[model samples]
Target: MKSSNLLGYAMALIGASFFSLKAVLVKLAYLPSEGANVVLAQNELEPITLLALRMGFSVPAYILIGFWAWRKLADKPSFLPVVQAFALGILGYYLCALLDFTGLLYITAQLERILLFTYPIFVVIIGTMFFGGKITRWSVLAILLAYAGIGVIFAGGEIATGANVMLGSVLIIFTAFLFAMFQLFAKGLINQMGSWVFTCTAMTGAAVSILLHFTISASMGEGVAASLDLPPRVIFIGAAIAFFSTIIPSFLVNIAIDKIGSQTTAVLAMIGPITTIIAAIILLGEPFGWVDALGTAITISGIALYTFFERRSQPIRAIPLKT
Candidate 1:
């Protein structure tokens, strides 16, 4: 690979790694509600409330950053793409987050994450369907291998018996599809808009969606009342998550995807689940079993093989290969 392509791969991998770490962080941030001792357990955090708070704080920051980027533009910006970007952001990231977070209330983190990782497959399928692109044989093989690997990891674990778990699993899978749509929309819009402007608009859209949800939920008495009752460190942690998991990694991945391609990015995306499993073990003290380790290795190997063989069969050029 050329040095530039190598750099793009490295950036994409880093972004994916950060994205993986988010699973661990989200699990850590999620605290089981204990009526009396909730404060002491799991760092006194509430996932939904913290999520609302994080988006609330991020709005101004995104606006500021977006403005900074807008000022640097040489031509006048069009409003339509910005609006489209905002919609994608709200529908894709924010709504999916709502489903994922709510689903977390009913499911295990590992299961939630594995289901979310199904997005790469959806992305490939949707891109082919809507964009008139063809899916290669290797992509099919990778999907099978990845799903099998997930099964291997959870082989001995009891299937969640509750209806909530089943429902949550379905929501997580749907959320993955939503996220896939989000990426596809972002990719299309980003071609015409700067990454910063497009992202900021979409983030603003997500922020608005979260705020509206919080307001409606609060009116219905479903809102988190004590979200701000915690010490300031919790707020800091939330911001750190927004910045690291959302902002920085997104910036990195967008540029990298533009430099390379989403398929390349997706192949490297396996790094996310691997990092999440490891981070779960290290930070959350979640057990690391032989099954988990072996499954992760198999999944990564499958992804790599798919990407390698596919890339080898196709010709490389200065332009990116379409996803």
Candidate 2:
């Protein structure tokens, strides 16, 4: 492969690895620390509170980057596209993140990552149903394979027995749908304003929305203030989520797409679920039985097949950078 392609692949791999860490970190943040007499243990921090922290630390960087991109623009984009980008950002990041974080409370991080990884299948389904896109036989087969993997996992009985696992799985499935919609709708805006500018703008919008959410919840006496008074280790984990998972991967994936095309970048991103599985096992002591292994393999293979066939039939388009 060319040097650019090689670099792009490297970026994608690294970005996916970083992105995979988000689930593990969130899980870590949820676990109560043993014998730590801190003001607030990890379990005390709610999803909204954690989301607020993640966005709070990351937004300033996004604003600075957006401003830089805006300054570098040869021509100023219209206000309408900017507004639309903001709305899409709320849908994609703010709402999607809220649901994801909440779902993680009820499910294992490994399962959460696997479910989220199925977003592409939702993309294909949504595209066919609403966007006048045609579904070939390969698409149908891909869908079956992906869902079959999910079914296999459910069949394992371990996940089924977990309290609210179904609820968590449903929430994540919806999150996947919203993310797919964001990917489809945000393409035009990304074209209108360049990728970096569009991304930063969207992320800033998400950050603002999350802060507002936290503010509202705090006013309602949800212990939001107490959650913010985190221990050093939790604070560090939050920062890692913001910088390592959200900001860095966002830029890396974008750069990868620019270099090697979204199709290739996406293929490289298959590393994400695998990374999450390993991290969950090592960090969270999550079980990874044969059933989990088989399901994950099936799900990934299905998505990969779908991507390959989708690229063959359609022209390459930009993959939306997800936080």
Candidate 3:
């Protein structure tokens, strides 16, 4: 491989690893703090609050980088693209994130990641159903394998984790659906505005939405000051999430796409769920039985097969930027 290709592969691998860590970090933030100076039970930290903190720490960098990206463009993009990007951002990042975070509270991190991994499958289904995109035998087989894997994990999860797991799984499935929609609609805007400009705009919009949500909720209940008075450990975890999971991986994945093309970068990103599974096992002491292993392998295999067929059938498009 050339030096650039090597760098792109490395970036993709590292980016996927970082992105995989978000679930682990979110779970950690949910754990109760042990120190004497505990301001609030860590478990009391709401999903919206954590989401606010994450966007708070990361949005500044998005703005700065976005400004640079805008400056680099020879011709300015239209205002309509910016508005459209913002709407897509709200769909992809804000709403999807709210569902994912709340769902994580109920499900194991491993299960959450596995369920979310099925978004690409949704993309194919949505494309064919609504966009008149052609679906082949390979697509059918891939969907079967993927859902079979989901059924395996979902059945096992219910027995092990209880009824709440079903609710969480449903929420995450909806999140995946919304994300698939976001990816489908975002391509034109990304092409017009460029990835960096579009991403920054979308993320900024999500950040604003999160902040407004936190403000309204906090004022109505605990008051804004009280909500912001998080314990030091919780604050640290939020910062760590912002840096390791959000900011770094966002830039790395985009750069990787530029260097290696989205198809190749995407194949490399298949490592994300495996990374999450291992991290959940080690860090959160989440259960990972034979069933989980088997299901995960099948799910990944299905997605990989889908990617292979999709790559052959269609021209390459940029992968959706993760929020």
Candidate 4:
């Protein structure tokens, strides 16, 4: 690889590392404080409220960056592509994040993470379906290994678990799929519009979508009621998440992707789950049982194999007629 490409890969790795730490933060923030006398339940803030807080607070930070970039470049940002990119971000990253957070209330962070990390498998499946790529034997094997690891981790050391476990696991899987779709759409838009422009627009889309959803849900009695008593810790943690997970990683990954093409970028993304699992054990004090260890190793191994093996084949050329 060229020095520039190497630098881009390094940037992508750094972004992935930051993203990996996100699961740890989200789990910590949403996890309830102990004791029956605690005034607020961890899950008390409605899911929409959490989502709103996430996007609402982060939007301004991104806007400032976008404005700076625009002024520096001496260009009016293109509106249409940016909007489309925003829609993709809202649907892919934000919506999926909402689902992941909700599911976290019911599942172990490690298990939930394993399920969410299946996004790469979903990406491959969706790519094959829509883009007409063949799912080779290697791809099939990789998918099975990855999902089986998820199953082991999600079962929580008992292979025979109940319905709630299954439900949360399914939610994680769905989150992964949604994010895969997000990537497809976002990357398409990014190719046309630069990453900064694309991310700003997409984050705006996400912010507006979250706000509108909160408003409509509240109006319909489905929203998190406006609480006059906002806990300082909850607010601070929420802001931390928005800043670290979405705002910071968004720009970093954008820069990384600009440096490296999509394929290498996606491969580096595997780092998130690897880092998340370790962080879960150390930071969250989550147990790393035999099942968890084996499963994570198996999953990461499969991903590495797939990444190493999935080399692009050169297109066939037509033969020239004999003179």
lDDT tens digits, residues 196-264, model 4? 866776677778887887778777764345441355666776787788777777777777767776557
How far is 164's C-alpha from truth in model 4 (Å)? 2.3
- As a whole number from 0 to 100, the lDDT of residue 294 in candidate 2 is 91
Error of 4 at 310 (Å): 3.1
What tens-digit string does per-residue lDDT give for candidate 2 at 121-145? Answer: 7787788888777888998898899
Per-model C-alpha lDDT, please?
0.68, 0.85, 0.86, 0.67
Please give, for residues 1-323, the per-residue lDDT of candidate 1 as tens digits. Answer: 79889999998988888766655666666654445433535424545566777687778888998889889878746888888888888886688887777676666666666667666667667877885556778878877887777677657443233457678788888888778777766766776887778778888898888877776666566345544555455566677678777777877787787788866776776677667766766776666566666766666666566567556654111111111
In angstroms, how far off is 110's CA in candidate 2? 0.8
What local lDDT does model 4 show for residue 145? 84
Scored by lDDT, model 2 comes in at 0.85
Model 4, residue pairs in steric clash: 86-202
Model 3 spans with C-alpha error above 4 angstroms: 39-43, 157-160, 315-321
Candidate 1 lowest-lDDT run of ten: 314-323
Which candidate should be chosen as best, given TM-score against the real structure? 3
lDDT of 3 by residue, 247-293 (tens): 89998999999999888888998999989888988998888888878
TM-score of 1: 0.80
Report the error of model 1 at residue 248, Å: 2.4
Q: Could you tell me the C-alpha RMSD of candidate 2 in Å?
A: 1.8
The TM-score measured for candidate 3 stands at 0.96
List TM-scores for all candidates, in order: 0.80, 0.95, 0.96, 0.83
**True-structure Cα RMSD, model 1:** 4.5
* Least well predicted 10-residue stretch by lDDT in candidate 4: 314-323
Q: What TM-score does prediction 4 earn?
A: 0.83
